[model samples]
Target: MSNATQTDRWTDSPRARWLAVAVYAVAMAWVESAVVLYLRTLTQRLDPATTTPLPPLERVTEAELVREAATLIMLGAVGWLAGRDRRTRAGYGLLAFGLWDIFYYVFLKPLTSWPRSLLDWDVLFLLPLPWWGPVAAPVSVALLMVLWGSLVTQLPPQRLQRSPPGLVWVLTALGVVLALYVFMADAIRVAPQGRQALQNLLPTRFNWLLFGCAWLLMATPVLHLLIQLTRRQPAQPTASQPE
Candidate 1:
């Protein structure tokens, strides 16, 4: 087949693209679930509410780092696979991430009905900030993921005219900072009371405002990129041009 024909054949095959997405989602889900199960086994002895004094910075475990690295690798691989074409891949990545997260909860519910409501507290991360929030928090994020995924997947391909990288990056960073602040606000307030009292501090209304702001900030880039991609154009000049 000619190169043009082969390229057209590949891009036109939506079935293949979607099948690949399914396989990737299942594989990644299995890996993630297994790792999480193992971690739970290891930390089973620790009480969720227990607040021990923070360990010395030097004493942090390699196991923790490895787990984090593994998780990133799994997520990154999905993006890498999908990003074969920038626009297509962004869509695929967004959809994959969003679906994976949503289904994680769906599958977990059968095993343990822990998050019975949107207000149930859950750990959102384990890094420096260690995000903690209600189920509604991540669900809201998943909704954004769906919006971003739809935009990326459904829009026509085009080169980014504006290249709003600086704006995008700034918004992304602000979002992360805001998320961290909101999650850790309770911990921060309780820090003055000493480590022993930290467990009693829960997220507050102000944190919810911060979370809302952060969520909107994070979504700005995706929305902007989508709008740019979907903007319509006037028809190009035909062979008969006004002279």
Candidate 2:
């Protein structure tokens, strides 16, 4: 077979598809773990007393960005492979995110035993809110991603209905807003705090509620789609109708 045909055959095969995803995930985890280790070392080297109050936007070194970018490029390749089939791409994306997430924690255990428990604090992401919580927080999100992926991939093609593009845009916007609220919560609380207080002013109870509500909202689209897929259908009319 030609090289292109051989490549196509491998990607189309179930075993190859899964193996590719697993390898991609492992590479991503390794890169992330290494970057984190380097960052911790950098942090230790810095003089905490003399460092500026605000973190630098380019704190991550050029080498680190190159490594991270390579990992992301690999992830995008896996996404492209997984998304080859429209029927199952959503499922692939969901599984890709979840597995990548869970394995990141798994690989980090040996590199640095930081999170001893599920409640250990973590910076989930860097964008707006920097998600903070125990290890369980992202794990929960990963599980949800898996659920959404399974639902998307398993549904029959006949049952799949696209929501209005406007509705999709609305949901996407709401999701971003909710995510920001959850992430910047600490910053929001600090706005009213006294000098030298590095803590968030928001009550723990409120934070928990907000987090729970945000998660539920994220799950809504997937849940609705799943219901549509699983619902029993009525029999179709016969060709021999009464005259």
Candidate 3:
């Protein structure tokens, strides 16, 4: 084949899946950051660490919350399309989420000097409730997701044949719930008073120990998978070979 044809084939190959996902994630993150920039510009809540981080409820309408939900759906759809099976689909989803999250900060730093440091706090999500955490928190999780997702997606098929048990998933789900609780603790505390109270609240402390435990628990399946892959033995010869 000609060099050009070879290049094209390589670009279309399975090995290039990560590249495609990364490109799409970067673009999505850029667009999302731009949207946030516009919103901050409009609301004048540019610095997330200020006393009043979130805009008044009037300024942040239901539409904005809906848009966030829509973004998640879109991310999930991209993963579904990129992966060949459920596990790989989940890997792609994590890959997309991780890249989008990391690049959200990357694209934001240039536009808004917010998140001055990794320790800077911000409002994370608003589905069941508003999640609050330092920039380092989600970034740390995203990095782990990238690592796990890469392993899941790039490992040889034979290495991935050993599926994680149901107990592992249960532990993972518990870990997720614990982590969410940690993030939403402040918001939940103020929720009874209403949106204003919740928005006005600033998190004073983060339970790092609990978060660490949760993070390690969440990593169980990935670690187990890796162990299995490592312990996997080569198939033995079906017949004796002549010396």
lDDT: which candidate is best? 3
For candidate 1, write residues 74-158 as lDDT tens digits: 6656756755566567667766766666666665554344456677666555564345777687777866775676555555454
Write down the TM-score for model 1: 0.69
What is the per-residue lDDT of model 3 for residues 90-165, given as tens digits with 9 covering 90 to 100? 8888989999999999989999988789988878887778888998999988887887888888887777665788
On TM-score, the candidate that comes out on top is 3
Candidate 2: misplaced stretches above 4 Å? 1-19, 45-74, 85-90, 162-173, 188-206, 233-243
| Candidate 1 lowest-lDDT run of ten | 45-54
TM per candidate = 0.69, 0.67, 0.91
* Residue pairs with clashing backbones, model 2: 119-134, 129-183, 129-184
TM-score, model 2 to reference? 0.67
Task: Please give the range of 10 consecutive residues that has the lowest summed lDDT in model 2.
Answer: 45-54
lDDT of 3 at 163: 72
Worst 10-residue stretch by lDDT in candidate 3?
Answer: 52-61
Residue 2 CA displacement from its true place in model 2, Å: 17
